[model samples]
Target: MLQLVDFIARNRFFLVFVLLEIFSGWLIVRSNSYWGATYFNTSNYYVAKTLAFSNSAREYTRLGEINSDLANENARLNALVATLSQKNAKDAPVGYVPDSAFNARFTYKVAKVVDNETNRTNNYITIDKGSADGIEPDMGVISATGVVGKVRFCSKNYSIVTSILHPQFMVSSKLIRSNEIGTAKWPGKDPNFVDMVDVSRYTKVYKGDSAVTSNVNAVFPPGIMVGKVKSVTVHPDQTFYNIVLELATDFRNLSYVYVVKNRQLGEQETLKQRLGDRR
Candidate 1:
């Protein structure tokens, strides 16, 4: 206690000077209009900045919820648009200028890809949908950008899809510009590219030509876009054109996809079968 008193006695003069200086500064600022205005302005700037940061943080926290709601709304609107287009097309007469049927056939049933594989020779995707969700084998699976594959198997709550990159996967696709059709197949070499065979050599073919499903087979509807022609190679001895296609869908980065359900699929197939039997 005696030592502390000695130290305080020695620093008493300096401490008093510091206190007086601080008091003088405060008095000067309070008395001067410009100083007071400057201090308040600086304080307000900091206060406003802090408030803005706080509000931004709050908004950032709610962004996920907002984004989810927007995505749902977009999907709903797209479905409505598709339904209206289909109705309009069906009502149109035989000679009417038909809107490209591709846009109408793509009905989306959004499902998350729970599991996916691209490196394997027999790559497959597992989605969080099943028979209970109206998903069945041969149902066309696609994303907003383009085609993914077809449903191969389904359980009550889950489904497996055969990717277009698979060796067994074959889709009937045609050139969008010329309507020259071919069989799209994967060579099990490149995941990004597929081979389109049986395109006639006489047809005008070029790179960057869009390829879409022919829908001749009952598996997928006509007009679902498959890919774009990346390269075309014509063998001197071969009669058909061999074209390489760049797939529209990025299989490696697949996340959400839709399983298409055709309401009139059964009836259409039944009528075709009866006609075939009679023929």
Candidate 2:
């Protein structure tokens, strides 16, 4: 306390000068109309700007929550579309369903990506969902843009995805224009490119042709986007075309994904198993 008093005493003149300066400025602003107006205007501008900055910061902080809500809403809309299309198909005349009446076998659940890896041969992604969220092994995972992966394993609250970037990950896909079917696979080399194999060499394929999931696959719903043709090559004595595809999902930028839940999958599997048993 003594030291503080001594310090204040030593700086008393300087402190007095600062107080006088503040008082003089206040007097000028109060007495002069121009000064008062200018001071208030400047202070108001700063106050408005500060309030705006605070509001922006608050909104920015809520972006994740906003995005999660949007993703969930999108999932709900997708489910609704699937349900409507199914209803339309059932109501349509046999062998004459409209294109819009064709429905897929899958519904969706939104999940936020928690981890992702694209560089490894067996790359995987993790999401903030699992059995508790109805996610299971073999459930197809997709983003807003396109296919992402399939569920490989899961805990009660988290699931791991076998990414399309993984060498073992393969999906039945077809050329949208030509309807040429092929198997899309990653060759353990490039994350941006996947290889579409088993497409007949004679099939007409073009650059930028979209590849989408085929109905033959039980895991993914038919017509879900897979990728686009980046390049095509023909080899001597080879019956299949060597094709490179620009992947639909950008693994590097993955944030949220939808896990496909095929409601009839269990029934379908049981029937298939019974048929095999009879055979």
Candidate 3:
């Protein structure tokens, strides 16, 4: 306390000058209309800037939560679309469109893709969801753009997805223009393209044909977009055309995915199991 008093005593003249300067500035601003306006305008500008910076920082920290809410909302929309489509499918023109996909009842779950591999030979995706979240093996995973993959395995809090780029990965897809069914497979070199094999040369495939999932099994709902036919090639001896598809889902930008749960899948599997046992 003695030292503080001595130090203040020594700087008394400077301290008084600083206080007088502050008081003079305040008096000028208060007495002069122009100065008061300018002072308040400047202070308000800085105050607004400060508030904006602080608000931006707060919002930046909540990005993860915002993304999660968006994912959940997307899931709800997907489920709602599935339900509504099934009810309205019968009104469509007969034979022009397949109604099986729309008929399927699906439950949607939002999942964040924690890890994704595109360059690897057997590319797999890891997601931040698992059995604990009602995710399980064989559940189809899809992005907002298109089909992603199916769940391969799951732990209590995480799951691995079999990427469409995997060599063994195949989704039954049909060219929309020609309605030709083919197996969409990745041959393990380029991640951007998938091969649509088993399509008969006479199927009348063409460039720009959109390929979508077909009603093969309960894995994926029919009509989910797979890709577009980039090229269609045929060799002299080949029975099937080498149809190249530009994948709709960009694996490099994969961040969030929706897991599809078919409400009727369990019943279908149970029936198949009983039939197999009888055989």
Candidate 4:
């Protein structure tokens, strides 16, 4: 108690001066409209700026939720587009009638990419969805821009995808301009590019030609973009052109993807097994 009294006594003069200064400033602002207006404007301006900054910080924290919502909406749109494309097809072929659910061949669901690998030879991706979400092995996965990969395995709430960057991964693709079909596979060299082999050298392939999933693809829907031709080269000894594709999806930046569920996939596989169409 004695030390507190002594400390106050020591700062009494300075404390009195500070209080007088504050009171004088308040009196000036209260008596003068210009000063009051200036002070209010300045204070309100700073307060508004501080509130804006705080709101922006809060928004930054919710980016994950925002992106997930966008992905879900995009997946729904994709399914709608697929359904429309089916409806535009021949409604009744000669001597054949399609079922009511024929247009519902493909359905899409959004999954956030929880983990991704792009620097390895056999790069894989993990998503925050699985068989519980209707995702299964061999199901197609894609980003908004293009093809991503196929589901290799699935648990109750997660799935591992064999990324297109993997050397062993291959997809049936064709040049959009020439429609020459080829097998798109990674060379284990660069993440931005893939090799499209078996495209006939005689075909008029060009740089910048889009490569898309072909009708022959079992996993992905036809016309879904895979990439664009980065380069096309051929040697005298080679029958097929050495074509390079600049991948559409930047795997390093993947946050979300849409998994494609083909309703007839099981039936198709069963038929293939029975027919011994192993290739």
Candidate achieving the largest TM-score: 4
What local lDDT does model 3 show for residue 254?
89
Model 2 bad stretches (over 4 Å): 1-12, 31-33, 81-105
What C-alpha lDDT do the candidate models reach, one value each?
A: 0.81, 0.88, 0.89, 0.89
What is the Cα-based TM-score of model 1?
A: 0.73
**Best candidate according to lDDT:** 4
TM-score of the candidate numbered 3?
0.84
Write the number of the candidate with greater TM-score, choosing between 1 and 2.
2
Model 2 per-residue lDDT tens digits across residues 40-154: 9999999999999999999999999999999989888777765664556433577865443235557898999999998886899999999998888989898887889999999
Over 41-160, each residue of candidate 4 has an lDDT whose tens digit, in order, gives: 999999999999999999999998998888889888888876776566443467664465766788898998999999998999999998888888989999998999999999999999
TM-score of candidate 4 relative to the true fold: 0.84
Clashes of 4: 0
Q: List the residue pairs that clash in candidate 2.
A: none
lDDT of 3 at 122: 96
- Per-candidate clashes come to 0, 0, 0, 0
- In model 4, which range of ten residues has the least summed lDDT? 89-98
Candidate 3 segments exceeding 4 Å error: 1-7, 90-104, 203-206, 273-279
Tell me how candidate 3 scores on lDDT: 0.89
CA error at residue 42 for candidate 3, angstroms: 2.0
